[model samples]
Target: MIAVVQRVNSSWVEVDGKIVGKIGKGINILLGVVKGDTEEDIEKLLKKVPFLRIFEDDKGKMNLSLIDIKGEALVISQFTLAGNVKKGRRPSFDDAEEPERARELYEKFVKKLSEYVPVQTGIFAAHMKVFIENDGPVTFIINSKEL
Candidate 1:
């Protein structure tokens, strides 16, 4: 499992020109499940994301967390995070999990995130148009395989 976490003033996802999921001031999480990822991977990332101290504090320093600020979350399934581009001009998705397993883990990830904060989500395996108003432009790439 891997995640691209972004602090956002707001964000939303649209599918087939219809608004699907959206959030207010909070984090927008783009999550990916690789071939061997499990529930443990999702559990780790769920704990890490909201507790990340990317929000500013009293002195305007990045100190407060989403948990401290009581923010929402928008979760989107994005398997391309595992895209292997080193081999050739075209990226390979052989590292990505099969769609069936990916959807299961994706839902598990969403459920885990919802445990920490209010959560909204994009449709699994759907073509989505995502709009993110990145605050602090703060982004972090987290991989379960790394830790």
Candidate 2:
């Protein structure tokens, strides 16, 4: 599992012109589930994301966390994060988990995140247009394999 988390002023996901999920003053998480990912991966992320100090503190230092600010989270399934472009021009997704398993894990991830803060999600396996207003342009990439 991998997560590309971005601090955002606001974010939204639209599918077929219908808005499915939206949030304000939160983090926009583009998450990916690769082959071999499991519950432990999801569990760890829930604890990590909310506690990550990406927001600013009173002194303008990056010390505040999402939980500290009571912000929301917008998570989107993004298998492409695991795409390998080292070989051919066309990226290979062989490292990505199967769609069914990815969907299940993604939903579990969202459930776990919801425990810490208000969580929103994009439609699974659907074509979504995501609008993200990045805050401080703060972004972090995390991989479950690291742990």
Total clashing residue pairs per candidate? Answer: 0, 0
**Residue 60 C-alpha lDDT in model 2:** 96
lDDT of 2 by residue, 22-141 (tens): 999989999999999999999878768899998999899999999999999999999999899999799999999999999999998888789889999999989999999999899999
The residue pairs that clash in candidate 1, if any, are none
Off by over 4 Å in 1: none
Cα lDDT tens digits for candidate 1, 1-147: 989999999999999999999999999999989999999898788778889999999999999899899999999999999899998799999999999999999998888778889999999999999999999899999998776
Query: Candidate 2 — worst ten consecutive residues by lDDT sum?
Result: 42-51
Number of the predicted model whose lDDT against the real structure is largest: 2
What's the CA error at residue 16 for candidate 1, in Å?
1.0
Task: List TM-scores for all candidates, in order.
Answer: 0.97, 0.98
Where model 2 places Cα greater than 4 Å from the true spot, the runs are: none
